[model samples]
Target: MASTTDTKNYKFNHSMIRVKDPKASIKFYEHLGMSLLKKLPFPDAKFDLYFLGYDAPQSVSHGKEIWDREGLVELTHNYGSEADPNYKVNNGNRDPDRGFGHTCISVDNLQAACQRIEDAGYKFQKKLSDGRMKQIAFVLDPDEYWVEVIGQKSVEETEGVTTTDPATYRMNHTMIRVKDAEKSLKFYQEVMGMSLYRTNENEKAGFNLYFLGYPGEKGVPQGYQADREGILELTWNYGTEKDEKFSYYDGNSKDSEGRQGFGHICISVDNIEAACKRFEESGVTWKKKLTDGRMKNIAFVLDPDGYWIEVVQNERFSGKPNF
Candidate 1:
């Protein structure tokens, strides 16, 4: 029997979002402690790209850092006559809401993190992470997309834990658009047992937002204890019909069938059998189950909303207690 922490195959790369202003967005993350990594300018493409992370320089002895570099968040600014497939470009129409999709980061101090962000002259949409005794703040880039920050030390400060690793990128949190924020909130909180950290009905902004997570976990798993960087972002357009299929350009689309949209999310567990059993006991259904196949010992499950999620007993990092 494997425990939830036994699955070590779980990993989150980065959540990609479309931004109208790249430089401003870059400054937003920089304010949260992320450094500018590599910036790629597509001269032929009229788009500027930037990558930011909180890791030290690479070592000479090791070829390339595997699971030991700083966590990273990528931002791309596209300049052109591009149109959001789902949204019509009308001058009369207002801008999309700030919650369309957002990213969250872990910081050293919850209050300090929020203060720092507020000090930067940015408008915060949500309070610091306090509901769960963690510092979490929500602010938006110039494009109106929200980015959250959580105190990294909280997880590390837990009873006993130390998050140290260059590759240990704390990739936590995932938010997506739903037909009804209330319904989605209830689904996660009531069904999944996640505590509703915070939510907003920003009619003035043309949308609503909600953030939920495991209510009492000292910190999310992977690295840095609790004081890590990043969160999952979700965006749901208000008073809009659920599209049969949406787009997945990291812009404004959630096409389930198309290549674009919120892809499946993964959760690592120590014991795949027990984790799957817990979900089954809780009434969650499986989309794919572990079996003899290409990715052995892996299974997929779906939330009530039809979004896919992966549950696995990561066999790679089998040495750690909650890896």
Candidate 2:
């Protein structure tokens, strides 16, 4: 258990995904109004990290400081993933067993955004009119990664009509598939101090969707999951727990084939030392502890199902605010 001083709040920073072609991936997100906030290259590590965000005025100067922006996408490009013709980034579409799911972007006008995406010569996995869920659609990126498109309004309001608004667009949430819903839920709730904001269990569909968020004292009000930002969606297939060997492919894992697709989810904490101490006391699995890496301020903790969760000091990325 964390001491009173060690109990600090956490904010979702970014979700990373491995990209085959940086140019194409960046273009795809740019088409959706995400600007490249910063690009950090680790020559020794043989990889580069590109951070992209939704909203930024010209007056706002962004670099590493843009970490303060919620819902940012970090595209990780290995040294030769693009140059090697045989290398492939698992987008989860081809392999249903992959752990990473789709990342969502909320737009003021779902129809207009879909049209824009279509006009840009992109194809949709599920169009607005194609499914019973009219308000939501799925667009595929260059790597065949699913990007869920959601409208700002409720499903009832988006009935059969195209809404258009250019100004409203932002990163929403990243969904991940979990083998054991109960175990994963316990890790997130007990270890990370997150709250279960919403849950949707579809018996007919044979699955359950759980949305978790770090809502502080001001808890989430009823029926606000759709609008709530920076939430993580855990998709649990009803009977995966029955099979002892059943497990989803974590993008960060490697087995001579190369690194998997999706990278990790990052959370910013108030104090890195305290957080690390707490995690140690809780017996959470550590991928990269603060003392293990050159970047001493950042650490990576693995959830129950082996998904990497990055924990970092808030000030290290965003910097301390000026009083």
Candidate 3:
């Protein structure tokens, strides 16, 4: 289990993905009700970071630093990546590299939300009417990353609503494929100290989903799963764990045969040193230590599937400068 001391303070913060054009990416997310919270530029590093997120429940600040909120999306634009004609980022959804599936946004009116995206000239991976599952629709971003649009209610009830407004929209979850269900469950449950709130299985489709997150008191009743935040959805395809030749791309590593487009998910901790010490004794794999690179305040640890989970704190260790 995660160290009981600081684990309670650790919360899922944001998921990062690389984009070719920050302008186009920002426009896309803005259309989906996300506000650009702040932009961090690293001129020396030749890159910029754009943090976007929806307003947290009862939040007074319409705009605040994204790192202060939970469940934000970080769009990384490396300088001149847009100008490179030969640069092709693997979206991590194609053949032999199918690992990260999609990030979800729950809407009160699924039909209206899908119509808005389609009418905006954006591409759709799966329409509401597409496939056996008509309840959820998949829209593609500029990078062709899937953004799943799910409904707040059952399909029949959702479609019956006449209002065109998707009144409540929240960044629900980010889905990733894992090899072993049991092992993955153990890691997220015990090690990360997240609660497995719900599970869904498709017996004929040969897969199961486990939704894990930290629960809190929103003004609204937390009875619905859609109301919660910072959820991690793990997809376990039956038999992949036993297959000796099968593995998903870590998404941040260049060592994989496929190029990486998706980055890491971040979790905020109270004290970086205490968190690192507990993780070390637990034998968690380290992608980058707190002091390994130029960024001394953050660390990266690998999950069982090699996906990087970034560990960070809001302020410096000395508490002089607050981020």
Candidate 4:
């Protein structure tokens, strides 16, 4: 269990992924009803950060400015990745080594959403009829990154043909592949102070899905598992632990070829300095400490499987309520 102090201070903010073509990537997300909230360009760095989210009616007038940062997907585009032959970015399709999994979007009508995607000429990695678990489906974006589509209603409600209201769709969760379920679960629960909201096991598929989020008075309501925004889904595939050769690629790290893809997940802390001290005392490995980088207010910690968790001060990201 996470300590009360840690529980009170943490909020899951966003997950980032690298994209080769900003135009295509942005188009794909927009098709799913996510508006391009903001774009932060770093000409010196030769990259740009594009933040996309589902804008509520109140914030729609901001026009590319994201007042509510919850459930935002940060798309990092390296300027030369698409044009320069020497540049490489991981789309996660090269191999199982690409550890980053799919991000999810919840829709009021799953059938209609899937149809819209198909009508728009996007391919489905897993169709509604293609899987034993028909409640969810997977669609591939232009980058070939998987995007899971979940419905608001039960499987029974969506058994037949349905109509989709794109306006009701919103970014829900980001999934990451984990090697050891127990170890990752402990890290999220104890270190990050997130509650295990839900779990789904597929014996036939040889995998398990564990959803974790901050819950209670200061967090999301316990019953809001399906409708919650910005949840983290950890996927643990069985037998990966026993096989020493089996290792999922950390999208943030470089292989011999210098390819990178998915970046770290950000967690806003009420007191970043104090949180870092607690993490260090708990024996958590630091990837980039506040003192190490120029950005002294932010820090990064590594999970058991080497996935980076970025910790930033909540005050620095003021706008809407924290998760």
- Residue by residue across 103-214, what tens digits does model 3's lDDT show? 8888778887788888889999999888889988899998899998888777888676655453357788889999999988998877776778888999998999999875
Instruction: Predict model 1's lDDT versus the native.
Output: 0.49
Global local distance difference test of model 2: 0.78
Q: Which candidate model has the greater TM-score, 3 or 4? A: 3
Give all candidate RMSDs, comma-separated.
Answer: 10.7, 3.7, 3.3, 4.1
Instruction: Estimate TM-scores for all models.
Output: 0.46, 0.88, 0.90, 0.86
Which regions in candidate 3 have their CA more than 4 angstroms from the true location? 1-4, 56-65, 160-167, 217-224, 255-258, 315-323
User: Candidate 3: lDDT over CA atoms?
Assistant: 0.78
Q: Global CA lDDT of candidate 4, please?
A: 0.78
| Separate clash counts for every candidate | 47, 0, 0, 2
The digit string of per-residue lDDT tens for model 2 on 47-135 reads 99898876545211234355444578999988887888888777754554578889998876677779889989998999988968887
Tell me the deviation in Å of residue 152 in model 1.
Answer: 3.4
Q: Arrange candidates by TM-score, highest first: which order? A: 3, 2, 4, 1
Candidate 1 deviant stretches above 4 angstroms = 1-10, 56-71, 80-100, 129-135, 153-171, 177-225, 228-250, 253-323
Against the true structure, whose TM-score is highest? 3
